[model samples]
Target: MATLLHIDSSVFPHGASASRPVTDAFRRTWEEQHPQGTVIYRDLATDPVPHLTADAHLAGFSDPATHTPEQAAAFAARVALIEELEGADAVLIGAPMYNYSIPSTLKAWLDNVILAGRTFMAEDSKIKGTPVTIVASRGGSYAPGTPREDYEYVQTYLRAVLADTLGLDVDFIVPELTMAPQNPAMTELVPLYEASRERALEDATTKAKELTERLAA
Candidate 1:
């Protein structure tokens, strides 16, 4: 059976997090298609991984046999996280924008998982061609021509690391204006917010089924 790595980094609880529900939708759809498939879940909000420390950064490059106990422990964490990513055929990420960027917890996860010569190398990437679906939720509008279009960093940053570095096959599902309902300043865009949410779910459902079929094939 296919294996999926489902990761959620939203600080908010499930009911309050916009990205969580969208990722949940994709997960539900995927599970329906492959009831026996494996799902590896990591909730970064509650169980955040430590950011890459100086030792951890150096440990990634040093030979395993030469690692001291301190360096070994740091490198061990990266190995475990990398193993999870390497074992999965597909990945689902919930990346809610915090101040026009991804959560620090998510960034920490990335730093650990994207190791040189392990997740990637000079000529080829170890996780190359692995499909990754990112549900990017933003509070305010940041689409083309929007006032803060250039400020959108979540997708840009992920693409650079996941696709450019790790060589993952990446696609994004953006659910914009998530704060419209709660922000008085964005009250006028509530309808658009609803529409964006609906579209996000629809896109997730379709892409999920497609990915499942691909895996089965």
Candidate 2:
């Protein structure tokens, strides 16, 4: 069976937020499609990962065989986080746009997971890659190429970090404008938001099924 990791960073569970509900919907559909697949969940809101500290930084840069006791411990913790990602066939990230960026807890988790020579590598003066999906929740509409697109720093930052730093092929789905005031634009966005959510769930489920089937084969 394929292994899928579900990572949620939403502070709010279901109130005016697309992160939790949208991810939950995708997870449900995925499970239905792949009954034999295994799913593991990590709730960053309830149990946040530790941020990168000086000790971790030192250990990360040190040679594994020459690491000190403290550095070894730090390295072990970071290795555990990387192992989680390495073992998974697919990953689902549920994140809400906070101040036009990702939550600090989720950022910390990413720091722990994206380790040098683990999730990424600098070989032949270039980096290799992985794949990731981000289900994002936004309070305001910020479609790409639109006038307000510049306001979408969250998606932009995420795409850069996953693709550039960790060498991950990142896919994003934002169910936008969940808290906007009633207006003509808002009315137009309502159906758009619903359609986006539906497509996001379908895409996630399809990817999960494909991964599982490929692994089985």
Candidate 3:
């Protein structure tokens, strides 16, 4: 049976977070498409992983047999994280932009999982073809030519780390102006927000099903 690594990093809970519902939509459709598929769910907001540490960094490169108790423990956690990635048929990430970048929780998860030799090689990434869908939610519009385009660092950083470094081809389903309806100053953007939100939902459903077929094929 297929397995999906489902990760939510939004500090905002469901219903309040745009990324949350889009990821949920994908998960719901994915489950329907693969009734027997396994979901390795991780809520980074609720249970955040510790940021990368010196001990963990050293442990990542040390030989397992020579590791001290501390190194062994850290290495073991890293291994487990990598194992989850290795066992997944696809990955779904709820990556909401915070101050023009991904949440610290998601970044921490990446730091923990992006190990050397295990998930990648010196020249190429091991999981080069794995399907990764990122639901990228932003409070402001950042499409090309937009005033904040240069400030849109979430997708660019994620792509570099996931696709360039880890060899995963990532696709993004973006929902822009997520805070428009709530922000009085954003009243003019409500229409754009609504349109983008609707498109994001539809895309999530389509992409989730498409990923299943891609993985199985």
Candidate 4:
């Protein structure tokens, strides 16, 4: 059975934030669909990724074949992160939009995962592809063409990093924006928030099922 690596970085639980609920919903559905498949969950909020140091940066940019001991060690850590991604058939990222972008912890995790010549490569000046799914939660609405659309840097940047930098085919499910000031205020927003969470969870499960079938095929 296929293995799924789930990552969640939300600071809040199901009520205050959508990330946890969305991820939980997806995992539940995925488990039902692929009973034999295994799920590995990593919570960045609880156990965060180590920040990239200058030495780590230098090591990543250096030639692996000619790396010094320190550089090699750093490279090894990065390789380990990439290996996690490589070992999994699919990945689910549960992230809440913070300041119009992903949390620093999530970004650090991405930095560790997207290593040159490992997760991706420059083949004939073009990048190949892998597959990833992101379940994003935001406090306010920011769809394209909307006034707050420009605040959607989180999704935009994530798409670019996963696709262009890491060569991953990234899919996303954004629990429609909640907590916006509306006519009905809390009464209307609460239901909308709950509905979005349910939708996100369902979407994740469906995607996992489809992915597992494809892998099996």
Each candidate structure's TM-score, on Cα atoms with residue i matched to residue i, is 0.97, 0.82, 0.96, 0.85
Writing each residue's lDDT as its tens digit, candidate 3 over 1-217 gives 9899999999999968889999999999999998987999999999988788877889988777878888888777877888888888899999999998999999988999988877766454446678899999999999999988999899999999999889897999999998899999999999999999999999999999888887777
**Which of candidates 3 and 4 is the stronger one according to TM-score?**
3
Query: Mind giving the per-residue lDDT tens digits that candidate 1 earns over 1-217?
Result: 8889999999999899999989999999999988998999999999999999988999988888998898999989988999999899899999999988999999999999988887887465557899999999999878889999999999999999999889999999999999999999889999999999999999999999999888778
Worst ten in a row by lDDT for model 4: 122-131
lDDT score, candidate 4:
0.77
User: Each prediction's Cα RMSD?
Assistant: 1.1, 3.5, 1.3, 3.2
Instruction: Give the worst 10-residue stretch by lDDT in candidate 2.
Output: 122-131
User: What C-alpha lDDT values do all the predictions have?
Assistant: 0.93, 0.75, 0.90, 0.77
TM-score of 4: 0.85
Steric overlap count per candidate: 0, 0, 0, 0
Q: Give the TM-score of candidate 2.
A: 0.82
lDDT of 4 by residue, 1-217 (tens): 7678889998776666667877787788778877888888889888887777666778887777888887788778777776777777778898788888899999999888776655667563222445577888888778888789877887899988887677777889898655543435555677766777677778877887786677677
**Ten-residue region with minimum lDDT total, candidate 1:** 118-127
The alpha-carbon lDDT assigned to residue 216 of candidate 3 equals: 76
Question: 1 or 4: which has the higher TM-score?
Answer: 1
lDDT of 2 by residue, 99-176 (tens): 888999999988877766656675521223444668887877778777778888888888877887777667776777
Clash pairs for candidate 4: none
